[model samples]
Target: MQLSGLAPGDWVTVQARFTPQAAFLVAADGRTRTYAEGEQRITRLARALRQLGIGRGDRVALLAVDSPEYVEVLLACMKLGATYVALNFRLSPAEIRTVLAASGAQVIFHSARYQEIVDGCRLRDAIQFESGYEEFLAGGPDGGELPAVTNDDDILSISFTSGTTGTPKGVLQSQRMIKAITQSGVLELGLRPGDLIYSGAPLFHAAGFGHVLYGVARGGASVIMPQWDADLALSWLGSGRVRHATLVPSMIIQLLEHPELAEADFSGLRSIMYGGAPMPTSVVRRMADVFGCDLHNGFGAGTEAGGQLVLRPEDHRRALAGDEWLLGTIGRPAFGCDVRLLDPDGAEVPDGAVGVIASRGDTVMSGYLDRPDLTARAVRDGWFVAGDLAWKDQEGFLHLAGRADEMIIRGGENVYPVEIEDVLGGHAAVAEIAVVGEPDPHWGQVVTAVVALRDGHGTPSAAEVKEHCRGRLASYKVPQRIVVVANFPRNPAGKIDKLRLRELLAEGRIS
Candidate 1:
């Protein structure tokens, strides 16, 4: 029952031996892979990788969308003891080349859609998933002896940080981090053998990709979606095909806004795990009314760390009933994660006092790839601090303030954008909201709010938006200016690109 000592490949091997007929993967296109087929395919892929001069500690990169092949490549790398790097398909060719070079990838596997992009790059080897993948599988036998992965501390993969704040850095994901994260997810989400879990998150993201591996760890099938489509997702959930699902807040909102939402049957769902952004109370309540299943709000941990906290289903029930404030919190520390809120001096902060969120656990990554100095700064005394700021209330729930870098300073007073966004987002007209500080000679930085209005709602004037936050927040915390946009630019992971917004503001493009 314990999965702590197993390598990533061992997770598959165990299931193949014990439950060979169980479904391991259900792709978006209706392709299915049983545990036996998965083990054989992975073994063949590992052999193919070996033929390409890949070995232990070697780097192999994959640039593609979500597919059964993505999981195969990762597990093959694990079996070969090579390091896997999942390149973001959204990145431009120039950026992709840069990341490949940084990772020292010996070979690159990409889908046919990205053939031109991969062809333009200078790599030792490139295999197209559409044309070359089957041929590549033929390079090795269907099933054979594979290299053993000996060390738990060995790097299994490298996940890049979403470069919203700055340039992306490779976060080393070791076997230990992967196992710990998968175990935590299995326990917290109540995953069971043969369960059909669905997730819309891409395979490249650490958090999103974990769902794929979670299916393997728990002897279940992961229903993979190539892209986020609200209607398609509703149909799948309505048909009673998926027992558990993972989604973000935006995806949830989209499902709620769908024209056929009322017709969708979600009674088959056992639980819904949501994270990557905060959800509005309206959306949460509405979703609860529709789905009527457990809503788990997973929070914290960047690419450098795994999950830190989880606002469980019980908390959501309580918040929906009477204790509404619990909806604003990110719940308590997750299983096996030691979360702490520390001051500038690395001391724990008093209750209700804002401090940097720090965590120490097996889920934390080994280190940033080839950036020991940055790694040393990020991981101090075994705790990973990523500049996320939060405060623990008297009841032990943690409330997010904002990132240390994203905190707005106006007139020498510190302002957290989350507080302002939470207040203004409750407005009848606001569908999405982001707060940023615009440069002001008078106040050092002026608080600015950018928002998208709800469909079928009239535009709220800047004055009206400001007034909405006036009584809910402190005087200084209220937005000095409000700008309404049709939609905000988002990063690959679907987070509002504040860094991009700041750039547009500086160029006078967003005014």
Candidate 2:
């Protein structure tokens, strides 16, 4: 099924069950954009693209906030077998240049807000989103069916990971690969037709766009938030239509703290999904009680290939009943991925023994764009070793230890930073926190906690937080250094930037 020729003209030749009820997108303002209207727009866009020399198999990169237009362009590209590349708006123009250059995109459709950026990139050609969007749609070929001969193995996208190391890798997505993950994820979310699932997460990231597919697969409605906004998100949740949501732990903290949270009508909500990292157990308990909705939190290594594990709602409910330990476990291998817990020798370890979490599936990328050596190291024995350290229990739920690279080797004893972080995160004054390895002349690498505190609260000193962790974590696991900041630098997906944290340490600001 490996595709060599993927162009819109080709995919249109294939006949499959086309769902006419496909609602392309529903805006936050309650506008229903239909698939038929969207398809017409796509044809014009394809025609306009063709005029601009954007051909089959070409890359049409999008660098803008989420909207109905973004989805239209994506559908148009799909019609032509053109791979739609969604660029992260959070990245600096220079960082974006790296992606566009690496992607070899000929035409980039962007927002006017980024006019200066488009000018800075000095791209050979470009189109403004607001101005060109409608023009491209209305002017492209008054065409008959274009092409959509793409197959199951056709490459769909080149999604980049928001790495803590700052070296993002483009993980390729395939048609068949995502089909399986989306179906399963939709089921896990318990979405039904017309179920309003508000996704404020970045669409450029897997959680953002992938969730859209999950919603569509289940015949549900997905409401994109463009970016995270606590007040706006709460408005949607209280709007009575929104019945489901997926969030990162940090967002959960903000939502629960919002004043409206106390009175917000969450009666419509049946399930809530959380990931991108573990939420503090304290927050989880409060969410369960306050929202009166089932909390389904799980862990996964997200790459272009897709999600590796899911803590399904049923499993979470079962664990909440008695297996409280499952709160710390990442759950079992997902349907789409072949997971493994391997020791240094790449051999399987017994249940409860720590090892590296790895996965293999068609969803796994062919390779990181232009990083074959790195890809080789990652995809050994046909598995993408996610570089996350974890273990499986006898019941098969996975317990995340930490990032293998981030592990602090103290006097030869490895310590996980997550354990210390979970302890510090429980404090009332703390809003969000990340632990990173800092240079130490004695221990080789000492653990440091970089914290962002709750508003109107005084910052906790290093010693103050160490005392808090002392009771819950091992003595060696307590942070030796604490750095206070208003906010941590985040990638598009909202994961804190540890590389920037290292710079803060080198400047003697924290350590």
Candidate 3:
């Protein structure tokens, strides 16, 4: 039962040998791959990558939509001991370039749809999936002996931060870290053999890949969607094959809003795992009632630290019966994980006092890639400072107060104000700009930009400002509301007072 000594690829090899005919992956397009078939493809890919001069410790960047090829590349990297760099497809060309340069990725594998963007990036040794992938695999021998991956600390993947505050730092995750997360997920989420897990989140994100890894380790089948669609998800649920699903709160809301939901059958779904943002109590109640499935809510920082806290099924029942206070809490620290609320001086804070949430465990990332200074600042001693504000109640449940940084969570996507501010600062009519999140019913929050126009320039409409950002940033990062002001309030140090701006927005004084 121990999964410690084996890496993810090792597990895949074992599963292929023992249960070769079992379905391992089913794509939205209805293409299916068994455990043995997946291992064979990964073996071929590992050999191809080795022939291209990629070996242990080398970084391989993958920029593509969700597909079986994506998982193949990931496992291939794991088998070869090369670092996997998962690039977000939503990023603009400029953003993609920055990540490629920072990761020192010598080779990139991209989907055909993004070939134009990849060409624009001028990446060295790029392999396009449409035309180059099959030929690339043909160039190398298949089912060859590979190098041994014995070191637990060898970097397995480098997941970049959301870059909300500044440049996205690469979080270096090791085999040990991923193993810890897989074990924790299996135990905490009750993953079992033969379970059919469904996931719509992009594999570039930790939550998405982590779910797949969990299914692989448990010898279960996984159904992956290229993108989130309520109608497709409903159909999958009604098929009576899906037993578990990982989703964000926004997706749950959309599924409930779908007209077909009234007739959909959810009898096969045993559990629904949600996270990445807070879930409204009302929504949580309605989902449980409609599906009659256990609801598990998890909270954690990005890829750096895997899941830290998870609200169990029993907690949901208690909250539904009138202990409503538990609805806002993120339950207790997960098994094998340690969490603490520390003051600025790194001292533990008293219960019920807001403080920075820090965690340390086997699941924590090794460090930031090539950035020792940032690694030191983020990890003190052994704990990683989450940069999230929260307070623990008397019963030890953690209640999130707010973010210590100005990162916006728009429909589970992390949108940094600084990235948006940098893009808008170049506008001809914009004198000064600040971005913040405004509460929304469907999406947890919407990006709102408050701008101060130059004296001689004419005021720009909200649509005009958003149109200017359309090409420069991702669609989710574009400001939904643009508020023009003559001047911004400043603190004593002459810095723009963002706190004051938020207050004005809340009071309806700024629009």
lDDT of 3 by residue, 147-262 (tens): 44747889999998765446777999989999999999989989898788986678888888888999999998888887667888989976778999988755676687677887
Error of 2 at 380 (Å): 2.0
TM-score of 3: 0.80
Q: lDDT tens digits, residues 377-430, model 1?
A: 999999999998999988899999989998999999999998888777788887
Model 3 lDDT, residue 166, Cα: 60
Please report how far candidate 2 places residue 284 from its true position, in Å: 0.6
Candidate of highest lDDT: 1
Stretches off by above 4 angstroms in model 1 are 144-147
lDDT, ranked from best to worst: 1, 3, 2
The weakest ten consecutive residues by lDDT in model 2 span 8-17
Q: Mind sharing the TM-score for model 1?
A: 0.97
- The clash number for model 2 is 13
Per-candidate Cα lDDT values, in order, are: 0.85, 0.72, 0.82
Q: What is the lDDT of candidate 1?
A: 0.85
